[model samples]
Target chain A: MSFKTTVITILIYFYAACGATAQEPTNYSAKNGLPTNHVYDVQEDKDGVMWFATNRGLVKFDGKNFKAFTIKEGLPNNDVWELYLDGKKRLWVFSKSRYQSYVLNDSIYNFATSDGKTISPAPIYEVDNALWLRAGYYKFDGAEFKVQNDYATFYHGGSQQVFQKHGLNAEAAAVSYDFIFNQYFLIKDGELWFLNADGTVLKK
Target chain B: MSRRDSQSAYRFGNLFILINDKGIIVINTIAHTLKHIAFKDLNIFIQPFDTNQKCVFVNNTYQISVPNYLLIFNAGFELIEKHPFPEALEIHHAFKDSRGHIWACSFKKGIFLYTAAQLRTLYYLKGKK
Candidate 1:
């Protein structure tokens, strides 16, 4: 082979040798104009906009443009934990304050917001519009977070699954893209826990 | 998976919050299989027998930033290949699929399907001629 051909061949071979590795991250922080660098959770809104639950506040990012919200914005709480998009495309945010708040789709309300009472057995996800929260020992007002007789019925509204704290203040759990068959998971006791439809935790 | 290899890998961090901080390492499964456990690494439950198998996997990429370098490893854990990916990508996952496809996911950059000589080279790694 000619020297030029050999050199090009070697270059191609060298290039191919280096392309194998791991994957990359798609989301960006304030570097991408988000409100904060510490983003706890991110979910796609109905309109395809991405909402970030940040340490600073709530942020909405379209392909272009970013909007931020915080306690100053009349939100009952500012420290957000779980970020959920409901069946109606409305947004629900759970915070460390224990209150659950709701925002309508399309941000139509500039003057109204739904700030529910401090919820114990804090929220996890929204399955079909109902809030699927953890049914652990949580209390509201003076009621310590505890489970009651009606606790069984709560899972029907989606609390049937059990998930453990992944780590320090982690609010996300494993969600099977296939929602049915009850295959979602969370790490508990060093084992993968699957929330059974019958309110039982199964080892994965 | 075996102690034979240097397990000398660093943790990978993701810039996207959509993903949680995970424990992911890009390893040549074939090399792990070859160095120690015989038929086990193939995800095989049964069947055994082998010498120093070259194993599967074309290469592993070690990126400090984006699409970086393709790393090749021999039976002795020596790097025998080094390919560069200049596409400026962000990958998410890497492993062999059920269909013998060597898959890799980019961090929203896009997924790559190995075709042509790259796939050919990977076959050569897994004992395929």
Candidate 2:
């Protein structure tokens, strides 16, 4: 081969080697021990064990194997929608139809209010080192859920006006509050803006 | 626009990720810095793996149903890896485990495992061949 041809061949081989590093994703389905093919959410626990919420059940993946938990194993329903791991290391599972459950010691049980009613899935907020569900005014005392009628008081007042005062169309902006950090995040006109609870812009 | 089509914000540590019609905007509250990525002709959604977890899963789709690509970001709000998937696989959310393996949960096709080695390879594969 000519000298130029040999150099070109060597460069092509190097380029191919670099492009070959990104392999196709490995699939895991019912054929591979997954409970079902419809997965809704994925979460990892403190121990690094991966958990999946699926249409059929809640699946536990320990990197190499898959284990599923369904109604027979104490899940509220077969269709799980979301998963949340609280500060106490408990796994909270939200199922279809708003039924919520938590898994402790590898066992699933219903999450109910003080009156024995099932708690609907809502954004879990941590306050004062305790977990509270913004919807239905429920608070988890680490043992059971209790009613907290004045939970709305915890939210910062006049937060919407804060956005409007800053010349942002509050109605058009998507705003979310970080209770843990006491800050507000707003997305307006394709730009993200961060502000303090008192309406001072932190970053834009 | 429907509620699902509207913009949404999720917090991972001090980083705030906002998903809008244009793309994603990430802001670091402590550093007072911001980064934005515009994904043309794609709808974006984000779901953090856990409350304390510092990683965010970004699912990019076409027409809001067809899976197009997946982007994972670390605690510092930097794009760690990006991978394209089959359109048939509608991934809802993803999580990166402690071992650096990415677990992508799909709507009907099941979960996909992408190892750290495979993710690192994609870094070199960027740009036209």
Candidate 3:
């Protein structure tokens, strides 16, 4: 279908799915709650409430209403890479714009951007008690992750933007983490996946 | 790929040799149509949980399918033994959780951890905001 049609269809689908999972939840969205289109990360609190990391804010979805957290109020950054709910149910975040994190105690961890260079970020996931994160140029110890002295992948903004814009809305874009397979996968754009580690499908 | 295989019964596919959920290094293929394909030491046709839409049929001593909940297929693919899990209507994975119950998910039912012995539904995700 056309790009505009596809985008419309996707938004419709998500709105439908929102109420399809929980029968009695008060939602928070762009209209009455959180702002911005980029929902970068999502997590569930120990209380079973859910939180969404968006481009402008962090949204807390308590199955009834949404409460948004932003830099002005007390969020680390606007561009979050991933959201992790640790064993203690504290929220840990990974970001692409700046170096920052959120602790369970509602505190913010901030890092400054001193150099004139912009650092690209990468995928982040939580394993065990520690956090495993990859920055576009390299792995960050969570301090100030700067661009490499010479040149590197992490410092490449153009490539990172392309990767970030590749239709996370398409079915081809959905990613599932298989603990058993130990690999992150999703159908490549325009590629037909026949048999996946999940199940087999046949296109007519 | 479709243009090339438009008239054929099958098209080019990817194959990965899985040790089954067991430990047999059997071969597997991810293709659109398996009826027209041929192979050796073939067992059962099952799918593994890879993020990609593609599916693989590793082996078939006792086949596995997640028609139920969401959790770990954690150990990796094995074809030798049958590990008991929640019955899936279209499940990719499942969990027994803390209550000796099987929590299964469905494209129809958002999520639910079931009662013991697979007799009834205990808790399900209420889908309405």
Candidate 4:
């Protein structure tokens, strides 16, 4: 073999040797410890335990094993949507079927409106200090969730008018708060509305 | 070493990987060479995320998730494997955990766990207790 040809052949083998080794992944499914293979959300708690929210149940994993929880275990609903950890280290579980909160020492608490309306886990978000959950924005006052009606009014920069949330022609697509400017922004029919700290209308 | 098209960029050792809507561009800082890895046949927009740079997988790193596929490449910017997920309509986000495992969210189906060379499908199912 020619000297240059041998050099190229050795280089090919060297490159192949440096490639990744063929190692397959280890899967855990219903056949194993997990209650079901389908997992909507997976989160790790402060204690390092992994929590899996599934369609039929909620599963907890401690690195090796899986423990399932559902309505039978005091959870409000079976079909879980997402899991949120609030500032107080409390884990809040949202579900399209039901909503619940879990504390380490305390038991799971069901969430509902003051008027006896069960909060559905659809448009839930942890914005600023309080949670934008259910049909209203609420915060945990160390005992229960209290809905805040302080943000009842908002401004519209396009029409140059202010409208209440219950106004006849008022339509709100999405609502969010901006921490930087300490204001609330709402998207209504593709128009941006900014609200001051006191829920008063602000110009765009 | 510089690419403006990518929304995210990652550096591994002497190589810099830039990803955008088109494909991944791998640049070797020491060699002063740029190599483009195209996935045009797949018809998917490629994006890059921060991962363990020393995982010893593709490119002395790990895997990256495309919209419907997980592409694993080597340090030489060569294609290692293309793991497809037809059920995953769209991937909302993809990131690597502290355990060197890549997690991708499908938004509708469920989250996917990609570790080693195996793709484990975690379906969103529920059980009572």
Instruction: Give the alpha-carbon lDDT of every model.
Output: 0.38, 0.64, 0.38, 0.51
lDDT tens digits by residue: candidate 4, B58-108: 325445554555676665666665555543345433444445465554434
Pick the lDDT winner.
Answer: 2
Cα RMSD to the true fold for all candidates: 15.9, 7.2, 17.7, 14.3
Top candidate (TM-score): 2
lDDT of 1 by residue, A38-129 (tens): 54444555665656565676776655677777877645556554465555656666565544465654342222112333442132333333
- Per-candidate TM-score against the hidden true structure: 0.38, 0.65, 0.38, 0.51
Candidate 3 lDDT over A1-204, as tens digits, reads: 999999999999985674344322222345554565345444555565566656666666554566666777655566554455544556766555555566554556655333534434333323333333333332224465443332333133222333344433433342222222222233345343332222323231
Scoring each candidate complex against the real one, what DockQ results?
Answer: 0.04, 0.41, 0.04, 0.07
Among all windows of 10 consecutive residues in model 2 chain B, the one with the lowest summed lDDT is B57-66
Poorly placed runs, candidate 4 (over 4 Å): A1-26, A97-99, A103-112, A122-134, A150-203, B1-100, B105-111, B115-129
lDDT by residue (tens digit), candidate 2, A115-144: 566544544555445766545556777566
Q: Regarding lDDT, does 2 or 4 come out ahead? A: 2
Q: Which stretches of candidate 2 lie over 4 Å from their true place?
A: A1-22, A96-99, A115-128, A132-138, A146-148, A151-169, A177-204, B1-6, B11-17, B24-68, B121-128
Lowest lDDT 10-mer window, candidate 1 chain B? B11-20
Model 1 lDDT at residue B32: 18
Once fitted onto the true fold, the runs of candidate 3 whose alpha carbons sit more than 4 angstroms away are A1-28, A36-38, A74-76, A79-81, A86-89, A112-117, A125-130, A137-204, B1-72, B77-129
